[model samples]
Every structure is written in C-alpha cells, then in structure tokens.
Target: MDVVKYLQRAGYTTVQKSFYAKIAEWESWYIGNVRKFHRYRIYNGKSYVSCRRLGMGMAKKLSEDIADLLLNEKVQITIQDSSTHEFVTQVLNDNNFWVMGNDYQERKAYTGTVAYIPYLDAVRVSENGEIVDGGTVRINYVSAEDIYPLSWSNGYISECAFVFYKTVETKLYAQIQIHKLQNDQYVIENHVVECTNGAGREVPSEKWKDLKDFSGLSEWVETGASERQFVVDRLNIVNNYSKDNPMGIAIFANSIDILQGLDTIYDSYINEFVLGKKRIFVAPELLYTDPLGNPAFDPNDVTFYQLPEDTLKDGGKPITEIDMNLRADAHEKGINDNLNFLSVKCGFGQNHYRFDNGSVQTATQIISENSDMFRALKKHEIVLQSVLEELIRIIARLGQKMNIPTDPDSKMVIDFDDSIIEDKQAERSTDRTDMSMGILRHEEYRAKWYGETLEEARKNLPEQNQVIE
Candidate 1:
C-alpha cells in the first residue's frame, strides 16, 4: 500500500503532501550523489529528478530529511516482514523519534501513558521495519535507588503513596534523593559520620571555614560488588570498584531497593485484602463449584462462614527466614537493573537476584496443606506489614530532610561526560513498557484522590481521629 494513501485513509492532508515532496527530493538527491539510475516513485507518470548531479552534502541532507519524513506524523508507516508477526511502530515528533512494540506480541496498544522517550539519541526498533510518523523518543535516567533493603524485606504491604513516581523519570533530579544515608535493616559496615570538633558550630555552605579533626565517625560496609558488574556503560566503561570497602558511615548505602521493596510489600498486602473473592458477588449455587476450580476460600466472605475476627499474635521472631531470604532475592531483578546502570557510572556491583523457588515455595506448600502453617504465615504477613509501615515512615522523614530548597518547576538538564556522550547517544534506546497509561493514570488519580479525601474526611470526624489529640 502507498504510505500516503494508507495514512490518508487514517486522516491528514498537509502532512502527506510534505512527505511526498521530501521523498521526491530524496530520490533526486540520491541519484545525483550516487551517480546511479535514480529509481523514483511513479505518480501520475512523472520522472523525479536524479540526485547523482547534486553534491554529497545535498544527498546526505536529503537522506536525513527522508528519514525524518518517514516519521513525520503524516506518514503512518507500518513495516512487517511477510515472514514475521512482529511490526514496529514509529512516530515522529517535533524534535525526536519514538519506536515501540518490539515485544513478544506483534500488536501493541497505547492509551497515552506510554511515552517512548529514547535513551538520549539512539534509534528505537519495531517488530515491523517501518517507522511510524511523529515518533517521539524517550530518555532513561540511571538511578541508584528504585528499591529498599536490597538484602532484606524486598516488599511493602498495606500502603498508599500520593507521590508521582510512575511517569516521573528515574533521573537524579526527578528522583527522590536520600542524601542522609539513613540506616535500614541491611547495615553497611563502613560509613562516614560527621561532627564539628572545635566548637560544635554548624558550617554554612557558601563560606570556607577552617577545619579541625572531625568526630561522630560511624562504621559502614562498602563491598567491592560494583567491581564485578555485568555489562558496560555508554562510556565504554565497566564498573571497576576494586576496593574491598568503599567509604561510608552506615553498614549499607540506603539503596533504591528500599523504596521499591516497600512499595511491593504495600501492594502485595493490598492485593490479598482487596482482590479476594466477594461472597455477595458469588452466585449462591455456583459458589460451591466453579470451572477454574481454584476459587480461594476467603475468610473475609461473610456468607461463606462466620469468620472470627483476626487476632493479633504475640511478638516473635520471623520463622520464615529461608522464604524471606528467597523473596528478597527474587525482588532484586529490577534493583539490579538500576545497579547495573550505576555500576557503569561509578563502578561495577555484585548483582543479587530475589530467589523465588525454594523457601517461598516450601512455605506456600506448607501453608496450603496445614492450617497451623497458614496461621503462622498470616501472623508473619501482619508483622511484615507493620515493619514496612515503619520503614516508610523513616524513609519519609529522610526524604523530608533530603529535600533541598529548589524550584519544583525547574527544567533540569543532565550533562553527560562529553568524551562518551557521542557513543552513548548512539546506543540503542528502550521503549516505555507501560502501555495502558489511561488506566494507570486513572488508578493513580483514584489513589491520590482517595487518600486525600479519606484524610480530609478523617480530620472532620473526631470519632475516627480522636486518638490524635
């Protein structure tokens, strides 16, 4: 199908004309530069000018223009091999090009939340060979923190965050900075603690002051993990921290995993509570028999049984250490992703994965067959939820302290090392994985609005908030 004709059916006229004009110029420019028989598109029996007569600059410029026009909003190009199910979608924007839908599935649906920001200046690929018009590129920020307690509780429960973490890029400025290096469960053995030795006077930022020896030294552990990172960075560099210990004040540097892990726990808790089967919705006759044959017997369903109120358990050590350790390992997949990027910047890092099969599987098996194990699991879950809440609170405080006075609406530019910027820009770009942006945005709004409304409602209801006084 003619690209313009196909796009014309989809709509847009001026956009099509612009592309045709550019395509003609490209054919002519190529003929003049390459001194070859210029093959041109036959439209109304017209021979387009050959580009062989034109200079190399004109040909090269035309080539760029042709590439740009391919992505112009007017040309909705769909490229697919007769042999393959994959098709790539590219859309040209005012200043960038975006390609998406290079996944297992041949088709991809974009609701709007999906922004295909290129990793700076790299080309995006598609299952189909053609580039869609008005393709916008995406930019990915290498982050240090995307999860919490990388070595410990890698999840959160019963939590609601009113923050804009979803669309907000994980770049340094866009990210929530934890500069204070607060202590979490995983302790770093070597850390740098500071204290003014002379007069306990606070030092101002702009002024240069005479410094004596410092106090408040703390121990933090700096493992040479980054030295063993897997891949290379855009700078053609690898993580190379060979030191057995990096300087630090805490046992471990508060990592991105802590925040991300907290979110997981919160989400998991909410899922078990809110996504359970509804007794009222279940038909009385079919409730006893379902086709999937795996309807969870939810205790919360009043119609199912006269379920007793959940009782609090006595404080005891977590018995599911093996399971917990495995869970932490399994959750580190994303954590390791950011770590890999960081390793390229600072040095290499020893990667860890959240183990999913062994202990977690065993615990699930035991809890499924034995009621006692189930109760213990429930108790552990409750404790885990409580612990996660405390962690969030601590992080929140650290976040507050870390917040520096800066414009919330500031446009920040990340400067890469000029030596490697060219190569980095040439690397392959990644497409945003999120597609159902509308639903996710809606969910985000609902969560935000729901939390605010609930908070306001509670403020007005002394009966609910009386404990505050």
Candidate 2:
C-alpha cells in the first residue's frame, strides 16, 4: 500500500491536519526564525540599494521565559499510604516522571495541548492463562494534534487514536494505536506502516490486545482510575483559538504584533545607521572622469584625493564625513516598549522584562507577590497541579492491573516551589511571627519553611524542640 493510501484508510484526516497545524505553531516558537523579518530597501537618491533587517526572536524568548518560570524545577509528588508511596516513588523514578512532567507542562505552554499515555510494557500471560505482572508500568507523553479522541463526554475520552512516527534502519514507519471499548473490554489495536514518498505499506503485526477491564476490577471500584490509560492536557484556552477544535493558544500568540513592530523598527534603525545617517561624501570634481567625461569614483581605489586650494577657489568642497544618530533614542524606546508588551501579554506582567544599557535584565527590585505576575504563575500552577494528580492516578491504576503490591486509592499531592523569585526569608519570618503569636503550629512552620510535609514536619518536631532547649 502507498503511504497516501495508508493515511486515507487510517481515517481522521481533519484531526491529522489540525495536529500538524499545532505542531507548526510549536516549531515556529521553539525553533526560531520561522517568522521571517522584513528587510527595508534604502534608497539615498543613489543607484545603490542597501537592504537591512534586525530579526529579534520574540516568540522563542517569550515561550522559553514562561516555560522556565513555570517548570524550572521538579514538582514534589506525595502519596498517602507508605507502601503505595514507596511503589509510586519507585515507578516515577524508574520512568523519570519528574522530568517528563516538567516537559509536559512546558509543551503545554508552547503547543497549548499535550497528553500522558499510561501503558503496560512487555505484557504476557501466565501458565494458568491469567494476566500477571511481566513488566514495569510505563508512561509516555504526546503532543495535542497527534492524539485524536473519537468521542468525548463529561470530560472523559471514550475512544481515541494516537499517531506517531518511528525510524528503523533509515526507513520511516508510522505507528498508530487505536484504543476503544469492545464487548466491555478495553482493547488497543496497534498498526505499523512503512511510509515512503507519500506511499505506505502496512507492516504485519498482532491485532488487538486487551487491557484489564474496570467493569470487574476491584481497584477500579475503590479508586477513580475509570480504566483510563490516557490523559489530555489542554492549556491557556481562549475561545479554542486555533480551529473549531480544542486546540489551545500558544503563550506568546498575543504578543506577535508587538514583536513584529519591534522587528520593523530595529531593521529601520540598522539601515539608518548603515546608510541613512552615516555615509562618505566627496566632491564630484575630485573624482576621476570616465571616457565619456562623466564624473565617477572607484569605491575600491585606495588612491588618496589631492584637493588643492585652487579647487576651493573654483567652488569645489573638500571630502566630508557625515555621521548622525537618527532615531536612535526612538529605536531603543520602541524596542523596550515592545519587550514590555510581549512580557505582559505572555503573563509576565509589566516591567518583568527590561532591555537597558545594551543588555536584558529581569526586574529584581520589586516584590512579585502583590503583582499580576504572581497571579499568572498561580493560574498556571493550578492547571499543572490537576494534570499531575491525574497522571499519578493513571500510574497507580497501572500498578494495580500489574498486580503489584501498591495502594490504588492513594492520593498525590503537588508542592510547587515559588520561593526562588520571591523573598522566602521574609515569608519564613512572617510564619515565625505567626507561630510566636500562637496562631501557627511549629509543625506548620517547619512544613512552610523547610518544604517538608506535615508528616515529615511532625517527625522533626521533637528534634526541633530539643535543639531549642
């Protein structure tokens, strides 16, 4: 089969197109220089045309700033049961979920949508013809367009397909997984196709594999897994701005106009510096004449022009150098204004970014707690917290299905560390003052100050009292 035919038979053409569009948006922001800068043609009444442009990568800068601010560090994951905690911790460490979660959040910021797929690896049947643990649970992430939910209801995906590409020995292959409900069973169909030059041939493989169905599972009844193996993360949605679908908006989408204006102004400034304000002017009489008696000068000629006093008497002016900083101040102001607009539009608040003295610096003098910047951070954190909790639940359900000794009903807690930007010592002092006034407990103080949980803080309470004594 041809690759085109494979795609046609694969179905969900509209979904694939939407996914590519979302990918293009992400690439435009992350890869940089996707949006070409406009070059201005400078005509100084001369035959020479000077083309100049200054392309500042605003999309890349804004997206990276927000990603770093939101997910620079690993999030804290806590489980309720001690045994379940150990199992969950081991599973997360084995799968590197901390790093994956950080990347997922960042991808959400850039692509506006992302997903977590929890799947069993190396599954096999036992000698008794029963499903048993054969491998560790694994979790992977996918961007928005690559995942297509066939049906959605009450915030749950009933059926879906995930399309991805793989390379084996320089040959490209398309791997499609369709997860659906069949006979009250959770079935997944894996299809592999060799794609070359818009043609595809389906690679032969086993058809359908059944996962543990929740209808008869005790873990599903106790825990709220819903037998889901996939979770879709939609971020920064403003009217589903991309298409009629749930394609989310990019973080820096609103700042594009300001960025373009900045680029235009910067390009004009460079051109003015090179051709408009700074130039070499020489008297036409001082230049050598051509065969047609036309006044001409060789730009490459190193010969010096000998201007005599008699030339001045004949109304000839000597060679003069012209240099002026035209619109230099305006250009600086315009660039800074655009940077501020871009920062605020991306939820960094005003004055969060500043370009001064030929360098960029974030404002360090102001307290962000009372500003809109902190509010924006909190808003993003709320979404991230929920996403992480759902991801943990999916992982716990996988453990349960594997028959691993784990607590399926264990809840996860996410602790975000925002003290890097704010004055954490000041917060600690306030907590201390509250504790001294009998409004706060020593355990609560330890949890807030040392980034420990209430359990961990309680364990340290006796040691703290002994040290104080």
Candidate 3:
C-alpha cells in the first residue's frame, strides 16, 4: 500500500505531510499537523492503508472496518474526497457516537476537496455540543413549536411555516389544528384565520383579540419561491403596533407513506388573543376564493388559476356576479360622490346656497345617499389625505373664479360644472348648473325669465317694445 500515491489519489497536494502523519506513534508535527476538515480534526496515521490494491473496486465494507478500528484506536485519517465523508460518517455513527445522527453534523466537507480515508477518531466536542442523537426518528414532518423558541407580532394571526427541502420526492399533506377550550371539552376548529389586510398580514375583524393558542404559526412546503422560507414558528396577524404574544400550534400529517414526506403547509391561529379558547387550525385555501377565481390553471382559459400548479386544489363557491359587481360598483360610486359632497360643502367658489334656517341645504342633500356611498375616504386619515390634494387644486381654481380666499390646510372642495350632473330633473351636465350664479357670471350668457321677469328683462329691447302694449 503506497501511502504517498494514496494521498495523491485522495488529491492531497502535500504528500509527505499527509503520509508521514499516519505512521507517527504519537501526535507528531510531521503527522500531527495533518490538515483541516470543517467538522473533523484531521491527522495522518499509518494503517494497513489501502492504496491502489483493490483495483477498481471501492469496497464500502473495507471502509467500514477501517472506520471501526480508527474509532477504537482513536487515530485520525484524512481521505481526499469529501464526497464520501457521509459514507464514512455513517460507519462512525453505527459503531459509536450514538446520539442524534443528522444534527450538529461533523460531516461538513467540500464536495470535491477532502474525504474520510477509513474512519477518524475524535472526542465529542462539548457538553453543550454533545448531541443525544436519540437514535434516528424517520420524521415525516417535524413541528418546530415544541423545540424552537418562537417570537411573533401580536394582534394578527401568525402562521407557522414548515419548509422541507430534500432531494427525495415525497408527498405529504399538513394542516394546523387548534382545540378551543370550552366547558372543559376541547373542540376542534378548522379554517379559523383570515388573510386580512388584502395581503396575508393582520387579522380581520373576525376573531377575538385575546384568544389563547394564538396563531402566528406558518406552515408550508419548501418551494423556494420566497427565501427565508422555513417552518420555525406559529403565525397570526396583529395590529401595526402589537407586541409579542406566545401560543401553541399543532401540526398534522395526511399519511406517512412517501419516502420524503415533509408535511408542507403555511398555517396560522385564527385568533390567538382570545382567552380560554381552544386552538384552531386552518388551511388557508379552505377559507379562500382564488384571487381571480379557478383554483388551478386550465390550459384552456387559465386566467385566474392557482400559481405553480402543484398545490392541491380546494374550492368553495363565490358570490354571484350581480352581487359582486353591485358591491364593487357601489364602492367606486361612493368615492366619487363623497368627493362631490365635499366640493359642494366647501362652496366650490359659489355663493353658498342657504335655506331660511341659514344651514346649507345642499350639504344635507350631499349626504342623503351616504348609506349607499362607498367610503373611499371613510377612515379619518384616508379621507383627509385623499382630499388634501384635490382640495389644493380646487382652492386654486376657486381663487381664479370668484377671487375667494383658499385655506392653506383645507381639504379642497369645489363645485362641479352643471352639465356634469345627472339629467333626472333638468340635465345639469351643461356648464351652467340648475343654479343661476354660474350663468350670471358668464359674459355672453343671456337670461331668460319665466313670465313677467322676461318682459322686465327685455324692457330695454328696442324692437319688441311695441308688442308689450
């Protein structure tokens, strides 16, 4: 067995440094200063080392035997290719170091760089670093809730995300389940959380604010769509100014059949802030309508299909077009009407029309349809902000028209041209409204009186005077 050539085959550049380390009795500098592998301590020691002997046959069994002896002998050896480190480590795992096999793994090696020759020996790194391998749990899915320390924003339902990114193909279905505590009986609740705030953020006005087992747990398969995608904590939506709230979230798997069944689902507590409540698990799609419609895309007319096409489809009915359109149109109309109302209330540079009561009657008229009006600017802040810009524009126009003083910090409101209104009564869409002020201000505008005013207004008429007699 040529140690020098073996090192060369292992791709070790410094042949003497690698080979001499093997035969040295004690940890000697020539052999003691072996090399570095990320997790394992590297040193060279002589073995009945295999060079190019078993010719073309890489016996995994021989590597296993060598690994056992190294562990018993407590000698360190370096293999050239790190690619086979897993195989060698498996032998070590089988012989000794029977703690958890997959975690805090000392198997970190560059794919093409160093490899484990036979097996190397080293003591467990630390009391804290010592892992009770707990043998191995062929975990179909691991819920991080029990182990990982989780923190999430309060007030909103949070989702617990579970990311399973493995090479082997597996199909596993996972859903979060919550049991509400009531009358000492735990009732299972499903589809409790809502994806409010348009996107999947804060909770809606649906759930109690202080429910226990608050959802902030997110669960899902590791699709690699959005990075930082891992299933570490529970999820829920909270207000913009919420503090951290803790709760329990449970994970359930469909079946344990697949070779790589990493249960993947994004989940949340419907309402965590509610006190004395059972945990509620929910599937997002269960309570959802596809943003546009169809759950999965159809090759035919897949306009509103689900993205990626891999997600299992769930369907519930949506409202009729009439209902949906009615609501949406109502919202749109509400915005426009509110603006109109604001314009009239602010006088729009017109002499404010007042009833005998001295209160503007038009203001009342503006709000008459408030019930049906969409609150485009309903929230105090939202409305004020929207009107601020339009208000400035209106003030500028009014100053030009009536020489009116514009309030600097006002929500600008101005009158609409008459012709722009509906014609139910007299069709006011013309430049002159049903009011007389706009007409009076026009230079070429003529006034037509109804009865006596016509004669009076025309009294200066030179030609028509004889007809009046």
Among the numbered candidates, top TM-score falls to 2
Which lDDT tens digits does candidate 2 get at residues 290-319? Answer: 889765777565443445546666776667
**Local error of candidate 3 at residue 356 (angstroms):** 32
Ranking of all predicted structures according to TM-score, beginning with the best and ending with the worst: 2, 1, 3
Flag regions of model 3 displaced more than 4 Å.
1-151, 154-174, 177-220, 227-469
Residue 275 deviation, candidate 1, in Å?
A: 55
| Residues 1-469, model 3: lDDT tens digits | 2323322453432213322222231121112121221113323585343211111111121122212211222222222223222333334445343232111111110000011111112212233322222122121223221111122343212222122221112322122232223344322222223222222222332342333333322211111112111222121111111123232211001111110111000001111112223322233343354778754323354223322232335343321111111233333333334334333322121221222221123322432144222121122123223322332332232222222332323322222111112232343234345335545322222222211223333443446332344
Model 2: lDDT to the true structure: 0.64
What TM value does model 2 have? 0.76
How many residue pairs clash in all the candidates, one count each? 81, 5, 76
Per-model lDDT:
0.24, 0.64, 0.24
Q: Identify the candidate with maximal lDDT.
A: 2
Q: Give candidate 1 regions above 4 Å deviation.
A: 1-369, 404-469
